[model samples]
Target: MRYLFLLFMLFTFQLNAQVVADDFEGFGTIYSWYGDDCIVDANFLNPYQQGINVSNTVLEYHDIGGQYANVQFDIDTTYDLTMNNSFSLNVYVPSSGLTGSEINQISLKLQDKNIEFPWMTQSEIVKPIVLDQWQTITFDFENDFYINLDSNSLPPIERTDFNRVVIQVNGENNDDEVLAYLDDVLYFDTVSNNPIYDNLVWFDEFDGNGPVDASKWFKQTQLIAGDSWANGELQHYTNRQDNSFLDNGSLKIVAKGETYNDQDVTKDYTSARLNSKFAFQYGRVEVRAKLPSIAGTWPAIWLLGKNINEDGGYWDAAGFGNTSWPLCGEIDIMEPNVAKNQILATWHWDNGSGYQINSNSVPSTNANTSQNWHIYTLEWSEDTMKIYMDDTLVNQMDSVNPFNQEYYILLNVAMGGSLGGDIQPGFNQDAMEIDYVRVYQETPLSVQHFEKNKVSFYPNPVQNKLHIDTHQFANTNTKVQITDLSGRIISKKQYAENGDTLIYNTSALNVGVYFMTLSFDNGINQTFKFIKQ
Candidate 1:
C-alpha cells in the first residue's frame, strides 16, 4: 500500500509541474515579495469575498498617496521568457476606495533588479481594470504588445534578465490614492531539464599542516595604497605562518591585535590574505567555513576578475592585469560583519557610466555564523549568479558583461573595516576556520553517461576492497573522495601517475550506503553509489 501511494503521488506531481511564482493562498515560490513606496499586506483577509475567485487571503496593496507606488518582488531564478512568456493574475479595485482621477488600469513590469534604476530597462504591459469586479488578466509578452522602457533593450522574449516583477494599479509620479487586492499571481513554465553542474573542475581540501600549497595559493602581503588597505582596514597582511596556517585538517586565518610594520608602515593589527592560483569562468564554488567570533573581525570568501590591475596580485604579477576595478568586477560570496550580526553577498562592476553595486544581507543570528560551520556557495552561470548559505538561497542577480570572464578566488580576514565596526576593547585574537573549497562546472556528458561510457567499478555491495577501472584517464592526477549519505567526508586519497586500475579499502567503513567521487585534473568528475556491507 505504501509503494502504491508513492507511485500515485509521483504521477500527480508530474501532471501538475507548472511553476507557480506566487499565490496568496500560501504555496508561493517567491518569498521576497514586498512593496516599493507603498503599503502592502501579503496575507490580508479578502475584503469583498463574493466573486468567481473567493480566496480566503490575498495581497492588499494600499498606495497611500506615494509617488511611484507599486508592489514588487525578486526571484532567485530569472524568468526564461523563451519558454514561459505569460503571466496571469486576479485583481480587484474598488472605485470608492480610490481618490485619484487617473486611468483605471494595472501595469505588470518585468525588470533587471541588479541595475541602479530597474525601471530604466524594464518591459511593461498595461491592462485595464474594471471597478467593483474581480477580473482575470493575462499579460503575454510573446503575443501581446509590450513597451521597453529603454529603447535599446532587447524584447522580453529574447532576454533572460528579468528577475523582478512589479504591479502597479495606476500610473506613477502622482500623489494618487489607490486600494487594490491581488491573488493567484503566476508565471507558467514547463518543467525545466537544464544541465547540472556535477563535474569537479578545481578544489583545495587544505590537507596537511604548516604553510598552504604554493602551487594552489599565493600569500598576498603587499600593502595597498600608501599606508592602509582599502575600506579603512586596520590590518597589515603578512606572509608569516602565524597569521595563516593549516591545522587539524583545516585552514585557519588568524587576526591578531598586535602592532605590525610592513612596507615602511606600522599597524595595530595583522592578518593574512591568500589568493588562489587557479582561475575559471562560470562555475559553482562551495566553501565550508566558520567565521571569526571577534566583534571587529571581517572574514570574507570572495572572487575578483583575473584582469584586475591591482599591484602585487597573483594574476597581475603574471602580466594579465589591464583594467582597474570596479571595471574588472568583484563577486563577494560571503562576508560577515560581526558587529551587525549580518552576512553580506555583494557584486561590484562598471555599468559603462560608473561603478554600480548590488548587495543582499542575511542576519547572522539566524545562521549562527560565528558559532557554527556553514557551507557558502556561489552558483555562477552565463545568465545569473545565485548565492547560497547552507543550501538556502540568499541573493541572486542577472549576469552582466563584466562577469562573463575569468575570476580568481580570495580568502582573507580584515580588521575594523568599513563594514566591520568597532573592535572589542580587550580583543586579542580570532580565527576563521575553513574545511574545504571546491569548484564544479558542467561537463559535456551527464553523470550517468560519464560513469557508463568512461569508467567502471566492481562490487557494488562489497565488504572490503573495491576496484575501479580508469584506463580511459591515464597519466593524470585524480582525487578520490568518499563520503557518507550525510555528506560527511570519510576519506580522501590522491592518485598521481596511476595505472589502469586503483584499489580503495573500505574495511573501516560500517555497513551503509556511501558515495565515491573521482575528480580528474582535466576538469571532469564522476560519482558512484555503492553499498558497504
Candidate 2:
C-alpha cells in the first residue's frame, strides 16, 4: 500500500514533457514531431519570414519598439499548464540603452477566449539589442506566469491553466521603429519558477593568487580631515597598501592612530575601504574575515545604496555635506565593536520617523575576532533579511522591509561611530582580514507537504532551554513524549490546539541524552535527536 501511494503521488506531479513552441534551425523551417502537424498562425511574428526586417550590431540584433512587430503561437495543449513547467527562447540585443516602461520590447500573456488585460509582470525595458550575438532568454511560467502590463500574483497551484502565450515588440514605446529578430525557442520543465535567484547567475570565488578582480571591485581614494562622513563616524580613508592589502590569499582593511591633512587634520591613523563597481538587488551575501585589535578601533562588513544622493556623484558623497549618508538606507551585515568580539546583523531605514536600527547580536568565543576567521552573512530577499554567524541565524530584520531596492556590498574598518566612541587615545594599527564574499538564493522547498506528516523533537546538547516550533503542523492532533535514551518516558503532553505552540521547560530535566517521539492520527511516526549540555 505504501509503494502504491508513493507511485500515485509521483504520477500526480504531472511532469512537463511537451514543447509548447519552437523555431529551431534559425527560423529556416517549423517542424512538428509525432507526424504531419506542420502549422503556422498569423498571430505569430517571425522576423526571418520576410514580413519584417531586423538589423544586427556587433553584439546582437536590434529593433525599435513601435516599429517592430509582435510574435504569437498556439500549442495543442490548452491552459492547464501549471507549476514546474517553463517557456524559453534566445534573444540577442546590441545596445545597452532602453527605458524601463517599454512594453513593446518583450511580453508574454495567457488569456481565456476574451484576451482582456490579464494580471502579470511584464519584462522591463533593456538596452538596445547588439549585433551578431546570441542571448538566451528563458521565461519560467511555473510561478503564476506574467504578461505585458499585467502582474502574476496568484499562487503556483492556482494559476496553472491558461490558453494563450503572446510575445510582443512594442509597449509604452513611442518610437515605432524597427523589428527585432529571434530564434531557437523551446519550453521545458524548470526546477523552480523564481527568475532573479534561480541559482544560475555568474559569480567569482575570489581564490586567485593575485589582486582582486579589477572588473568587479573599485578602490576609494579620499582623505577628509577628521574623516567624518555621517554616523558622526571617525577614521581617515586611504589607498595605502599598509592600510589595505591583498596578501597571503586575503584582503585586509587596517585601522590605526596616525594622521595626515590636506586641508584638515594632518595626524592620526589610516585605513582602507573597498566598494564594488556593480550593484545587486538581492542574494545571500557571506563574508569570512578576522577582526583587528585596537582599543578605539571598529571593523565592519556592510552594504550601501548605489544612488542615495546621486547629484554630486559616488566619490563626492562620502565627503560630508555632499550627501546625507544613512538617510538613503544602510544594511549593516557585520559590525564588531572593540568592546566586544561578537558580530551583529542590522538594518537602518527612514520610516518618515528618522533612522531606526533593528539588529541581532551573538557571543564570540574565538578569542578576540582578530585571531581567527569567521563567516558572517546577510541573507536578503524581497520579503526577508537575515544575519548569520557561521551557520547560526543570529538576528533577522523584524519587518522584512530593509531590502526593497538595489544595494552594493561594502567591507571596511571604521575608527569610530555611535558605538566606536570607546576608542582609546593610545591606539596604533590593526587589521581585519577577509577570505572572500559569496552570495546565493535559497531553493524553494515545499512546505504544504512537509506539514502533512507527523512531527517530532529530540534530546539535544543543551544546558539552558529546549523549544519545539509545533506551529508547523497546526491542523493535526499531535502529542509529544520525552524519554531517556534507554526507553524511559519522562513526560507526555498534549497541545491545547492543533498547533498551539508548546514549550518543554528544561529547567528541571537533568543534563543527559534523551529521546522524543511524535505520533499523528494518520499513523505516521516521527522522531528527532538532541543534546543537553
Candidate 2 lDDT by residue in tens digits, 432-502: 88888776654344223433332333223344555555444467666777754344578887654466344
User: Stretches of candidate 2 above 4 Å error?
Assistant: 1-212, 223-227, 310-327, 366-368, 398-402, 441-533
**Error in Å for residue 254 of model 1:** 0.4
Lowest lDDT block of 10, candidate 1: 2-11
Look at candidate 1 and give me any clashing residue pairs.
Answer: none
- lDDT by residue (4-116, candidate 1, tens digit) is 00000000111133354555655466677789888999999989765435557789999999899999988877887776667777899998879959978899999999989
TM of each candidate vs. truth: 0.56, 0.44
Candidate 2 lDDT trough over 10 residues, lowest sum: 1-10
Root-mean-square deviation of Cα positions for candidate 2 versus the true structure, in angstroms: 23.2
Per-residue lDDT of 231 in model 1: 93
